[model samples]
Target: MTYSGAVKVGGAADVHELADLMISKVAVGPMNNNAYLLRCRATGEQLLVDAANEAETLLSLIGDDGIASVVTTHRHGDHWEALRAVVDATGARTYAGRHDAEGIPVATDVLVDDGDTVTVGRVTLTARHLVGHTPGSIALIYDDPHGHPHVFTGDCLFPGGVGNTWGDPEAFARLLGDVETKLFDTLPDETWVYPGHGNDTSLGAERPHLAEWRERGW
Candidate 1:
């Protein structure tokens, strides 16, 4: 299916995106996790971002696209359960944060930090560290050809809910603060966000909820 209003990156039309990004909802898992397939629209340089609980299905979904890399948002098993299979099938380099790299639940080839950027086709994704959801959770920010920025937030933030937390309440508060100060404040309020799960939302819509989030003690 063609994207009705896919934000175009201008020159990449000639550069050819080796793949397309497709989202899948696997409901049988603990969470109805969303997995994204990053296939090069031009060269078919496939990549998988956070395989859901169904590792095998994740493998089949790529279906010989010759995946080149796997990027995980955090250490949760439900999010990275298929890392091993995806890596085995495509020999793709895996990227994760240093702290969670141990529980990455699989081996990885790249360890990233905030401010780091990775290139695929003509797009650039910069990683930002958001600590509330997990100590090592990272959100990726990228600008489309029109200069509009988009963020791929792992589990730190969601459409209507932020992930459940286990650490200090103050830290969880700080996580929300990070979303405000680092993410929502830094990008255009129009920036669209693709969270690890749930439907997409924009910085503009969610920006207003920061105060509400603070009031509820989430």
Candidate 2:
């Protein structure tokens, strides 16, 4: 079946196979958080993005291959609900944004910043820090050598608008500005966005609504 990037809690993951990497996206927890398991085809090394919830389900997906690292996109509780459990089970190193590391209970094995690189086998991903949704929310960028770029946005950029700012105008503006400058302005239209929740969308599909999202001030 074709990968649609639509998943629900307790359901099977939707897997997308790239040239060198295979991405498995699954929804877990009551909030329906999306956790991505990235496996490098060449070496079978794996890395997980946001061990959101359902430690048993995540471990089942991981199987015997095991995992190397787990990255928390930000300090949000929902985003890392199963971080400790997953890390303890897999013995994976933990990574989180530098500014938000203190907020997470699990000791951060690595503190990521904008432009920092994390690797799964030979595949390297660049971290993009997107503020406002959280002080240190990060999005991982995988520039496929044979295809369009793929971004894993954590509560930063969603399909309809940027993540909620709780009616805070300043926070909304900062998030929009960072998204526009670092994401929309820099990435190509074909870039695939896998968000922290809900279905996936591309930059091309969302670029036209940038002005509208800003005007709404969400």
Model 2 is weakest, by summed lDDT over 10 consecutive residues, at: 53-62
- What's model 2's lDDT at 158? 91
Residue-level lDDT of model 1, residues 9-123, one tens digit each, is: 1111111121233333222255667666655455556666786567666676677656777789899888887778768777888998766788877886899888888655545
Tell me the tens digit of each residue's lDDT in model 2 across 1-218.
89999999999999999999999999997999999999999999999999998999899998899999999999989988898999999999999999999999999999999999999999999999999998999999999999999999999999989998899999999999999999999999999999999999999999999999988888
**How displaced is residue 102 in candidate 1, in Å?**
1.4
- Please list the C-alpha lDDT of all candidates, in the order they appear: 0.69, 0.95
TM-score of 1: 0.84
RMSD of each: 6.0, 0.6
Off by over 4 Å in 2: none
* CA lDDT for candidate 2: 0.95
